[model samples]
Target: MCRWLAYSGTPILLEELLYKPEHSLIDQSMHARLGVGTTNGDGFGVGWYTPDGPAEPTLFRGTGPAWGDDNLRELAHSVRSGLFLAHIRASTGTPVQQTNCHPFRHGRWLWLHNGRIRGFPTLKRTLMLAVDPELFPEIGGSTDSELMFYLALTFGLERDPVGAVERMVGWVEEVGHRYGIDHAMQMTVATSDGQRLWSFRYSSERNSRSLYCSTAVETLRTMYPENPVLQRVTEGTRIVVSEPLGGLVGAWQPIAESSYELVTPGMDVVGRFNPQSAQAGLPVPATVGANGG
Candidate 1:
């Protein structure tokens, strides 16, 4: 439905990932091999943190194909960030407006998603009503992606990201069930707090979107000992994307179905993620724990 990339570590121009890679995000916008569509021309956005800038990341967005935006190309070449997220949107039955573009933000957090709710229009009101009234006004678009973000916030994302997400999804399924819809969700979502990056891939039917996290830079370097590109990116750097940017062998690892990942300053962590249906009364929204390598 869409494509996105999240990056951390080694301050470098945005083009390093947006345009320079063999199958860069820009290239993906035109020829996405894994996305449902070959072109994601509806809109695009990017948010990034600068060492000396404000605590909140800077954002740039437009209601046109990323590959055709002159301003985006110029900015990508000029701005440098160690942490950033970029998205190319393919409308999932939503109007293609600048406001609907992804890499959505609130406070210092940025978010993007790559799938759709199976029957969002049918369940929009019911699902949205569940969002905290205080957080409701912050929603700027009609896409299920944005609603899902606020849902997570309503469930306490700032303090418990994984748990909040589980709760959010659980609540969605709860609503969908009330309407007799079987597969109400499909998502591969990425979010960042200007520090750590978190990503999740899951679906109601157990078959979710495609997502991958970069192999550890140290391991890639060891595997491609003669490749200078491997040496250039630091060991702490990480990238989570909707698909592999290129055909670099051993450079990407598939995230498991119904799973989530965390990229912190110290290490990368992965953990199980399953729907915690309210009907089942499971302890899903509880503090979801993880293990790091």
Candidate 2:
């Protein structure tokens, strides 16, 4: 329902990805090629870590379309970061307010999501109750995406990113099923804690939203030796997106369904995700032959 991109590599101006590509995130704001919605114009936001500035990332958000935001264009031209996240929203029954924009921040961490909880209105209260009381006050928006972030935090995202998210999804699905919902989850999410980036793709129905990560610079350089753009980035440079930024063949790889990828300094990781682990301490799934997502 929305579009987003996460970049980790040699520092570069935000425009390189937000505007320069033929199918950039800003372009996706108006002409998304792969999202469930053709245009993600409800709102937008960008968060970036300044290596020398603060432990927390800098965030700029707006309640209007990303493509029409002059402030966004200005910042995109001037702000440079090695690690950043950008998102353009397509509201799924949520109010269009600044606080509801993506790349939501909490201290050093930033989180965003694409896709909806199939029956969010019905599932909200139960899921909200699961959030830690201490962290609950920090929630400034009413979107399921933001709630998912808090739920992950409550489940220990600060210590274990993958496990925390799995628990979050499992808890959501568990609650949804108890309410007689058949498919309880659908999402492709990205979250970063200034140092590393973690991304996930999964849906209760098994056919989730789109998610992709950039091919390693070395691999791409070897394949397209004459491409000047490949020369600008370092070996550690990587990008994760709802869809490819450009039509460059072999420059992007699809993350499989029911999986996740973690991008760190040295070796990156890809792993199979299992929500069954989440059901351990939670209520058992009820069998009324119903579902949610």
Candidate 3:
């Protein structure tokens, strides 16, 4: 229901990615081509990491739309980072407030998701009841995306992100079914710990939202030898987005349904994802079918 991007690699001005591209995040706020919403103008946020600073990433968020926010344009040119996440929101049954913005933070971690849980209103109490009490108070907004983040944390995201996410989704579907709802999940989530980035695309119905990552930097450079932008970046550079920033033929690669990807210092990794198989990774105490006993 929104559009977003996660960047990891060479330190460059945020504007280089958020504003300069033909179909940049800023432009997408006004005219998103591939996302569920054509205009993700409800609100926006940007989170970036600085090597010399704290373990946690710094955040800049506003309740206003990105396209109308002059401050966003100014900050884009001023901040330079090797890793950052930007999101343009199109509210999915949540209030348009600053607290509901993306790139939600929890200590050193940063998470932002694009999609909604079907029938969340009915599933809210059950889902919220599943989160750890300590983690529950930290939830500042009333959005399903934020709740999913906390659910993952409660399920041990810091130690095993993929597994935690799987449990989170599995739990969502589990609750949705108990409430007589089908197709409970739809998400393309990206998260980072200032060191590595993880992204997932999955849904209850198997037709998840659109997501794409850049083709290997070297591969793109070889394919577009004439492109100067492709030439200057280091090999470790990677860009994951809701849609291609431009129409470069070889630049973007689609992520398959029921899959996840990780962008680390070495080569990026992609793997199949199944929420049903995700239970083992979660703590025994938090299994979806486990009783209050």
Deviation of model 1 at 156, angstroms = 0.6
Q: Which candidate is the best by lDDT?
A: 2
What lDDT tens digits, residue by residue, belong to model 2 across residues 240-261?
A: 9999988899999999999999
Candidate 2: residue 51 lDDT (0-100): 80
Question: Please, what are the lDDT tens digits per residue for candidate 3 over residues 1-293?
Answer: 89999999989999999999999999999999987768998899999999997777999999998988999999998999999999999998889999899989999999999989999887887688778887888999999999999989988899989889998988888777777789999999999989999999998888888999999988887888898987888899999999999998878999999999999987788999878533555543443443221
Give the per-residue Cα lDDT of candidate 1 at 238: 93
Per-candidate local distance difference test = 0.87, 0.90, 0.89
Q: Can you rank all candidates by TM-score, best first?
A: 3, 2, 1
The whole-model C-alpha lDDT of candidate 2 against the native structure comes to 0.90
Q: How many clashes in each candidate?
A: 0, 14, 0
lDDT of 1 by residue, 179-244 (tens): 788888899999989989999999999988789999998888888899977778788899999999
The residue-level lDDT of candidate 3 at 206 comes to 89
Worst 10 residues of 1 by lDDT: 284-293
